[model samples]
Target: MSSLDAEPHAPGADAPRSPGPLLAIESSCDETAAAVIAADRSVLSSVVSSQAALHERFGGVVPEIASRAHVERILPVIREALAEANVTPTDLSAIAVVTHPGLVGSLLVGVTAAKTLAAVWDLPLIAVDHLRAHLYACRIAYGEEAFPACGLVVSGGHTNWYDCPDAVRATLIGSTIDDAAGEAFDKVARLLGLPYPGGPSVQQAAEHGDPTAVPLPRPMMNRPELAVSFSGLKTAVRYAALGNPNSPEVPAPPLGERRIADLAASFQAAAVDVLVGKCDLALKQTGRPTLLVGGGVAANRALRVGLTDLCERRGVRLCIAPMELCVDNAAMAGLAWESFERGEFAPLDCDVTPGLVRA
Candidate 1:
C-alpha cells in the first residue's frame, strides 16, 4: 500500500480557503513529468525526468525500462513541480493525470499517483487523454483563439489528426495506417547510424545537406484520403543509405558524413511533404479557420516552415504550441481543466487505456 493510504480522506478538513492550482502528472511514455497549473490556466511549474539516456543503448524506447524509470522518478518529479510552483498539496483544488493511449505500465504509474493524491487530499480526480492533451497544448499557447481548429499530433508513437470542435472534445479524422512519421524517423536514423531520439538528430543532420539529393518516396501523398503511410518512405531511405543486398553493386560505397546528411535531409523532406499535403487536404475538406499542430515531431523546423507556408497560402491562421510544450509534458495537461470545468471527473477506479487510439 502507498504511504499516502494512511492519510484520512476528509473532504474539507485541510482544504485551502481559496481556489488554487491543480496538480497534473504525465508518465505516458519515456518521460515522467508533473506540473502545477493555476485556476486561470497559468502554469506555475513544470518538471520532466527524461529516460532518453537510459534507453539510448537500445536505439529506441523500451516499454519495460520506461515504466521502471517512472516508478523511481515520479515522486521526485512531482515534488519538484510542486515546489517550483510554490504550492503544497493542501493548497490544490484537484489532481489530474493522463490515463489513455500510452504505455499501460507508464500510464498506470501516473494514474496511481494522481489517484492516491486525490484521495489523500479529498480532492476531485480528472482523467486526461494523452492525444487530447497534445491538442490542448495549442490552446494553452494561443488561448481560446486556437480552438475549432484542425489538430495534428505527430509523436514517436502517434500520427493522427483531429477535428477539434472545442477544448475538451475532438474527433479523430485521420491517422497512420502503417508506421507513424516519427517512428519512420527513428528507424531511418538507425539505418543511417544516427543517434537515438531520431527526430532531432535527423533534423540536425539535415541542416547541412540537400533535401532534394534523396529520391525517397512520399507514400500516400498523392492520395485524397487523410490517412498516411511512411513504411515505404523508410524503406527507401534504408536502400539509399545502405546498398540493397539483392544488387551486385552492394559494395558501391559506405555512408560518409556528407552522404548521411544528404540522406537525412531527403528523408525529412519526404516525410514533411506528406504531412504538409495532409494538412492542406484537411483544411480543404473541413474548411476550419485555424490549423493547430502539436506533439514532438511538430517541433521539427522543416515541419514548422512547411506548415507556416501552407497556412499563409491558404489564408488559414496557424496555431502551434510553444517548443517547450511540444513534447510530452504534464503542463500540456490543459485538457484536464476543461474537464474540471464541466464537472466531468473520472472515477477513482478508472484504468488506463494502453493502445493507440484508432480513428
Candidate 2:
C-alpha cells in the first residue's frame, strides 16, 4: 500500500493462518523492513526500522549511513517479523528481497541477507524490483482488479508513471525530467526553513495556510504526453521564498511562521496540480479505466485528495495501497508469490542495479 494510498487490515494480524509464507526484506533506502506474507496474501507480520532520525540532521539520506544502518538492523527486523508471524525461516516457502532501482549499498544489505537466508534454509530466492513492489501494493489491496491499469509510482528516487498490464508487467509512459516530487518537497521545505523529509513537513504547514497565497509555477503542463517536471517548480519556490540570488534591487523577506505556511501551501498545491494533471493525461493515453498510485509521496494528503477528485470526475476506478502498505514495507512483497510460482528465482551472485529507472 502506498502510505499515499489507503488499505485496511492491520499488520501482524493475529489469527490461525496459512501454512507457509515468504520472508521479504526491504532495505532499499533508509528503512530496514521485513515481512512474512503467505501465498494466500495473509500478511502475518510486517516490521520496519526507519533510519529517518539518523538522516534528519543531514537534510536527506546519506547512502553510506543508510547502508550501515541496514546492516545493523536487517537481521533484527527480520527476526522480529518472524517472531510476530509465529514462523521460522524453515517455515517460509521462499526468501525475497527488493534488489534493484535503489541505493546500491542499501539494496545490497537486503539482497545479501535474503541470499544468505535462502542458501542456509535451502529456500528459493526471489528478487523483486523496487518499482514493481510499489505497484504490487495495489494488488495487495485490490486483488486482481488492480491490473491493466495506469500506475503512478512517486517516491524520493522515482516519479514515473506506468501502464501496468498485470502484476508483473509495466510499460513506462512518462516521468519527471528533473527532480522527483518528494525531492522538490524536501528542497522547498529547506528553502522555507522547514524540517527535513519535506513531504510531511510541507503537508503539515500547508494545512493552516492558503494554497493560493504564493503564485508558483507548474512546469511542463501543456506537453500532451504524461511527462512531468518539478525542478522548475522547486526553483520557483526558492525564488518566491528567497529573492533571486542574482537580483540586487529587492531584498528577500523574513520567513515568519505565517509566511512559511503560505509558501508551503502554495508550493504543495502547485506540485499536486502537476502530479494529478499528469495522471489525467496518463489515463487518456493508456485508455485504462483504473489508476493505481503508490510510493512515499503518494502519501501526501493533498495529492491523494487530488487523485480522488480526478478519478471521481473521470468516472475511473481507483485502487490505492493502504496507509500501512503505502510506505516501503514487506507486506507488498506478496508479489514474490508470482515469481515463485513462475519459477523465476534470482542467482546468489545477483547484484543490485541502483538508480536504474526502467524506461
Candidate 3:
C-alpha cells in the first residue's frame, strides 16, 4: 500500500493530507545516525553508531578515523533504522541528510550515501544544515510551540546563537570567537587526564568539587557584543593544571582527585556563566520570548541548570532538547520535513558545506 493510504485519520472522518515517513541520515561528525520519522513528529526508529572509543586514545576526534568509521557504519545504521521502523525505501516520502559545517570527509560519506539512495529510490532529496539540525532537536522535543525564540547551539565543533523565527529559518545572532564550549571542555579534560568526550567527564568530576574552589576567568563577559570566547578560559585551566609551560622542567605534582574535581568545577562554572550571560543578552536583544538550546553541550547538567534559572528569571519559555536528541543524531534531522512541506528539495548536484557561516 502507498504511504498516503497508511496515514492516520480522524475518527469517523476522512484523513487530511499529511507528509509520509522521511528517512534522515546524519554523519556530520563522528556519529553515524539514521531515523524514520512520520509527518506528525512521531519517530518510528532512530539509530546512532558512535566512534568515541576509536578516537579515545587520541584525546579528540581524529578526522580520518571518524570519516572512515562513518563510511563503514552508515549503510548498516540506515538499514537498521529502516528495519526497526518497519519501512522500506519505497515507503519513504523523502530522504534527508545533513550536508554542511562538519568534517568534510565525514560529511561526504553521509551525503554520498544519501545521494545514491535518492537516485536509486527516486526519492526527493532534502539538504539540512548540521547546526540547524541541532536546534531542530528542540522543535522535535517540544513541537511547533518551540519557535520564535533564540536558539543556542553548543557542541564540540560549534557554538552559535540564532534568532529562530520558525523551524527552517534561523538568523545568526552570535557565536564563539574562539574554541567552542564543548571543545574547551575536551581540551581541559585532556589537561586533567580525563577521557575523550569531555563534557560528561568534566560534569561528573565537578559534581564532587566546589565550583568556587578555584577562580577561572569568564572570557568576553564584559564585551558589548554577544560573542563568547573560551580560548583564554581554556588556557587558564591549563596553567592551573600544569603551571607555566616555560618553567616546567621539574616534574609537576600529580593532580589529586580533589584538585582535579575543583579545577573541573571552577572551569565548568566559568563556562556556564559566559554561556548564560550571552543567552540572556541574546534574548534581550532579539526580544524573543522563548529560548531553545541544543547540541551536545546542552546535555551538561550545569548548562541546563544555568539556562533554566536564566529563563525563569526573565520569564522566557525555555525548551531544551532531551539528552538523547541533544547529541548529534538523525532524529533531529527529521526537521527536513519542514523544508519538504515548503517544496525546498535540493537538486542532485548539491554539495556539502564545511563552514559554520553559510551564505
Candidate 4:
C-alpha cells in the first residue's frame, strides 16, 4: 500500500490511515543534513551543517575532507533535527537516506548512519537517489502542486533534462557529454579570481557587466543533440581574462566596479542562455507544459530570472525550490514517505552506490 492509501478514517466512509512520520538523512556532498516530515508531506524540522568554510580554502571540495566532515556533523545534525521536530526514534515509522550518485565516501557516511538508525530503532529503511532528491526538493519547497512536470536540474555537479512523472520516477532526456555545467562555472570563476563555488561569485560579478562585451561562443547551441558543453566557454573566459595573445578571446582587464560587473553579467548571461535554450528544446521535444529547475546552481538569481522569463514567454509554468532548499537539504527525501507505507525495509545488505548515475 502507498502512503496516500494509508490515511485515517473519513467522515462517513472510512479513509485510509496515514503511515507514521519519517526521519530522513542527507550526506550526499559537503552538507550533513537531517529532516523529520509527516505522511502529509509537511516538513516538521530540517537541519543542515555546511562545510563550505572547510572547502573554501581549497578552491573546491575535497571528497575525503567532505566525508570526514559528514562524520563529524551527522549525529549532531540528526539530533538537532529530531529535537526541533519534537520527535523521537519511537515516533518515526521509517528512515530514509540518500545513498547514490555523489562523492563515494560522503555517501557512505549517510548510508551507514541511516542503516544504523534503522537497525537500532527497527524501522523501515529507504534509499534515495541524490539527483532525484534534488527534484523532490522542489516539491517540498513549492508543495505537491509543483510536481509532475518536466524539470531541468542545473548545478556544479550536473545539468540535465528530465520528464518527471512524480517524485520517485524521472525519465532522463538531455545531459552533458563532457564536464558538468557547475564544474565549468568553478573553472571560469577560478580564472576570474572569483572565490570558490563559482556560480554565485560569477553571478554577482555579472550583475552590472555587459554580456555582449565578451563574444564567447555558445557550444552546442545549434547542435542536433540536446546535450550541453561549457568546457569551451570556460576556456574562452580564461583566455580572455589572461589576455592570451594566441587565443582570439578578449576581455577588458579585470578591474573597477563597472568592468567587473559587466564581465560577471556576460558570463552569467552566456551560461543561462545555453540553459534556457536547452530547456526550450526539452519542452518542445517532450511537450510538457510545466518547467521546474533545481540543484545548487539553481540558486543563481540570474539563471532563475532567465528561466522564469523564457518559461513565461513560452507559456510554460515555472516552479523552483526556495533558495534555502535549492542547494542541499534532507527535506527532499521522498523515500521517507515511500518507506513509511510500503515498509520496504533495507536489510544489512544496504550500502551506498556512489556512482549511482552518471548524469
Candidate whose TM-score is highest = 1
- Residue pairs in candidate 3 whose N, alpha carbon or C atoms collide under 3 angstroms: none
Sorted by TM-score (best first), the order is 1, 2, 3, 4
lDDT of 2 at 178: 86
Count of clashing pairs, candidate 1: 0
Candidate 2 off by > 4 Å: 1-19, 357-359
Off by over 4 Å in 3: 1-18, 245-254
lDDT of 1 by residue, 138-213 (tens): 8888888887889899999999988887786688899999998889888988888899889999999999899999
Candidate 3's residue-wise lDDT over 1-359, tens digit each? 43322433223534555557999999998999999999987889999999999988998999999999998999889888988999876568889999998999999999999898887777789999988888888888898999888999999998999998888889998999889999999999999988988999999999999999878899998788989999999988887787858777754456899999999999999999999999999999999999999899999999999999999999999999999998999999988988988999999889999887552
- Stretches of candidate 4 off by over 4 Å are 1-17, 245-258, 356-359
| Tens digits of lDDT, candidate 2, 1-359 | 22112232344545775547888999899999999998877789999898888988778899999999999998889888988998766467788999888898999989998887777676778988888888889898888888889999998878999998888888888888889888888888878878888889999999989999889888997779778888888887887777887885876677788889999999989999998999999999998988998888988989999999999999999887788887888888888998987989999898888876574
Q: TM-scores for all candidates?
A: 0.95, 0.93, 0.93, 0.90
Output candidate 3 Cα RMSD.
4.6
In order, candidate lDDTs are 0.88, 0.86, 0.89, 0.79
Give one digit per residue, the lDDT tens place, for model 4 in 1-359: 32212333223534555566788999988889999988877899989998988987787889999999999889889888888998777667788998888898998999998887777676668888878878877777677777578888887788988998776668889998787888887877777678888888888777768989877778897776789988887776766666667744654475666756666677778888888888888888888777888888889887888888988899988988778778788988854575555656667667888763743
| Number of the top-ranking candidate, with lDDT as the measure | 3
